[model samples]
Target: MEPSKSEDIYKETKTAKVDDSHEFNEAEVKRLSNYLSTRVIEIVVGVSHKRTFYIHEGLLCYASEKFKIQLRGYFKEAQTGKIPDCQEDPELFAVFADFLYHDGWLRKRKSLYYSCEWVMVSRCYAMGERLGSKVFQRECLWKLQHSITLKKFTIANDALCRILKATTELPERTTGNEDPLRALVLRYAAGQISTLRKDPAFKELLDEHPELGCQILMRVTDDESDCQPSGAPPEKRFEDKVEFL
Candidate 1:
């Protein structure tokens, strides 16, 4: 990424004062300005043909501790001003950048482009997990929760496959009992269990990856009290209260 004149806009320090009551303080403005600036480190991602994203060192260091160590620590990337050969999909990395800059673009895009947005969020979450950025993971999980809770988002078949594969392939984390991304995906599938099961591609995917089937079954089993099969008759719960005076 080439340097642009806009780089000057982000030179403000954290203590820079606000000009107006409605305007943001220097920190917020500087962050946004830095996101827009072309003069900064270039992290080239992807294979065969590479794609570059221009990001400020300060913004990276501030938002991600991994980036802080990699860029400012004794790592070679710190001196080279380049983060090359990132293993994440270029498209997913782009989405990750948007998450960092636009501050979780998923919320805005979720309703407008449901399936695609969910896919991006899932991919971004996987990328975040791989990159060791809890901030990104939390943001992605937050979007997933909102989307699932609202029950309005659609997830693409290929996206689901990607997510499933990503989760299943992820090495077990010593810090937690289960992968959060897997749990989130299972919960999401449980929300629309019938629709997902009915999809031929989904069925084939489950067949190919029995681990996913196990996850779906586990999700259904765990939430069995709350999630009833579509055709099952509704069971009403009656509560009788007896108060002793």
Candidate 2:
């Protein structure tokens, strides 16, 4: 096959034809090839009848740690202007595939790019909780575009809100940004802070105050308390309350 044809084949195999994400740096092309191998091997084993659904605990940890380093390094370096042209880079999506193809943590193929898209927008959604924020963003976009055409404001809104939040023309961590709630979300998503919900300064937010508490979530699981109804009675628990008896 001609070199051009091979390149076309490679691009097609990745489902990577979004005009926005077609520019490939050589370093990135190599990086994605390796990650795709990881995804393919794990998937083949998953489909094999001979294989039990047990995780390779040791390998899992090793992979997770390695991927974290790669993931963080990729983005951290981006802070220095080395960032990939996110909306147009297939490599950005590969970085996300590293997390979503986890042997167990993920089961949905629909929004394979959801986490990446989410991460790209705000960085406050879950950070690396369920999946890395960037990974979640891409998955959402990919799934939404593939599955339906219902305007998907919720999906687009989610990505829009975060990305808009994450982008600060000039950022100030002390005062929070002018758009503090969005800033808060970025910090949480970037893993700079633990949880947006629990930040002490969150109590200080005057405008979008309620949203601060809503974003608090556990680090390990990324589980959070956002769905509590607005008019629902305040939770009645007696954890550390003082008794007036």
Candidate 3:
């Protein structure tokens, strides 16, 4: 059988070592190639001004169970070969497509701009949750955590507010278990509460999402017993408690 375009690209990527950190081993290349198919599905992102992405049906289904179900027999998407009117941000959906095809290319591209990285990852996590792709969600969360702990990337208040609102709106938020993304955000917020509280915009955000305020307060109170001396950074005191879900 002839190798598909995705397989050819993966082979080239492996040969070139496009991203050393996420180089696809031979076995991984073969595994990824297994999902290649000629059929393409058009996904329309955004509401008023839509952006479309043409994705391989097999790979799309393989990456997202939600897409698999939505594109199965008898569904409108199956009949039309299109998922129309998806509400995810077009740029964010582009990131999802990059993950489906090129793996770490998005990370390599976004690394240059540290300011927007957390917001991008957080939005990607929310999208992953919506698409029911645990692997994608895990990858995004790992990136977010890595940026926070190792790179010392601090999320801006406006970005945090956007992330918190996006995460809180997810259907999974009501599932009773503490969401890892939410926990991560709350932990970060708690650590930086002193500075965040001083921001008028953050104050308005708390009013808009009262639960966030409550959660931040609880996180701070709960960690007080384990806090280091006043000289220690708040993030250092709470950092150890973060658990990736």
Candidate 4:
């Protein structure tokens, strides 16, 4: 199905907060996105509904982009009694919760791994903007709730993702960013790759795929980088490589 006009928040961000001095720090918004990534979707969903906040993904990201400015606005309004709230307005909090939930979910999904992880990092920093240290405790709760086996499964999947990213040839040489890449590498190091666990065959495959975690320590930096194509040249004909079932 085609996405609804309501689902698109990227455009809204272009003019999201036109009246402000534009002094809000976007980098801070991105940096703080992760702390909220560990939250349960149910919790955020419940909060968003109860609060009547705009909780869809794109709007949430937009809210993050406008976080600092709106945050300042809220605080100022509170002091002046113009707004009776110290917490997020319904719309704002919903955006925050949606951003947090989607980002966290994306960060966890290996298949959806970011070539650059912009979504991942952005989600985290956005959460920090809303809830602060409380986000950290929620993350800890997430860790506590999951089993070690499940966690390991998650890690191994992430490792494969990282390895694929680092080894692939980007359409653009560089996006100058790392989203899922950093998290993926960490997952690999932390034993997320099941193949790395006890299967030597998978280990060998990983050993050969240089494109994994493609953004970090890219081929440009080293003489031995796997960015070089495989020794076997491309086949001139389909029959040369295709095996029939």
Best by lDDT: 3
Query: Please, what is the whole-model Cα lDDT of each candidate in the order they appear?
Result: 0.60, 0.32, 0.64, 0.33
Which one wins by lDDT: 2 or 3? 3
TM-score of each: 0.66, 0.21, 0.72, 0.26
Error of 3 at 195 (Å): 0.6
Measured by TM-score, the strongest candidate is: 3
* Best-to-worst ranking by lDDT: 3, 1, 4, 2
TM-score of 2: 0.21
Q: Indicate the worst ten consecutive residues by lDDT in candidate 4.
A: 231-240
The alpha-carbon deviation from the true structure for residue 99 of candidate 2, after best TM-score superposition, in angstroms, is: 7.9
Q: After superposition, how far is residue 183 of candidate 3 from its true place, in Å?
A: 0.4
Pitting candidate 1 against candidate 3, the one with the higher lDDT is: 3
Task: For candidate 4, write residues 1-245 as lDDT tens digits.
Answer: 23323223323333433334423255333433333342211111223234333233222333444332223343342133222222333443443454344344322323332323323333333333333323422332232223222333333434444334332311222666533223334333334333443555445544665334343334223332111222222221111233359
Between candidates 1 and 4, which one is better according to TM-score?
Answer: 1
For 1-245, candidate 3 gives per-residue lDDT tens digits of 24434234323333331112323345443354544543789998876678999998866765676676666544567778998766777888888897886556433323323546667778888878767677677667656654555434567777777777766754545668777777777777788888889988888877877777887888885543222122212111011233359
Cα deviation of 199, candidate 2, in Å: 27
lDDT of 2 by residue, 1-245 (tens): 12333233323334322222323345443232333332112211111132222222222222333223322333332133222222222333344444443422222333324645544433422222222233343333333233222223233333433453334322335754333334333333334333432544433441443443334333324422221112322222113233377
Local error of candidate 2 at residue 37 (angstroms): 4.6
| Candidate closer to the true structure by lDDT (higher is better), 1 or 2 | 1
Of candidates 3 and 2, the better by TM-score: 3
3 or 4, which is superior by TM-score?
Answer: 3
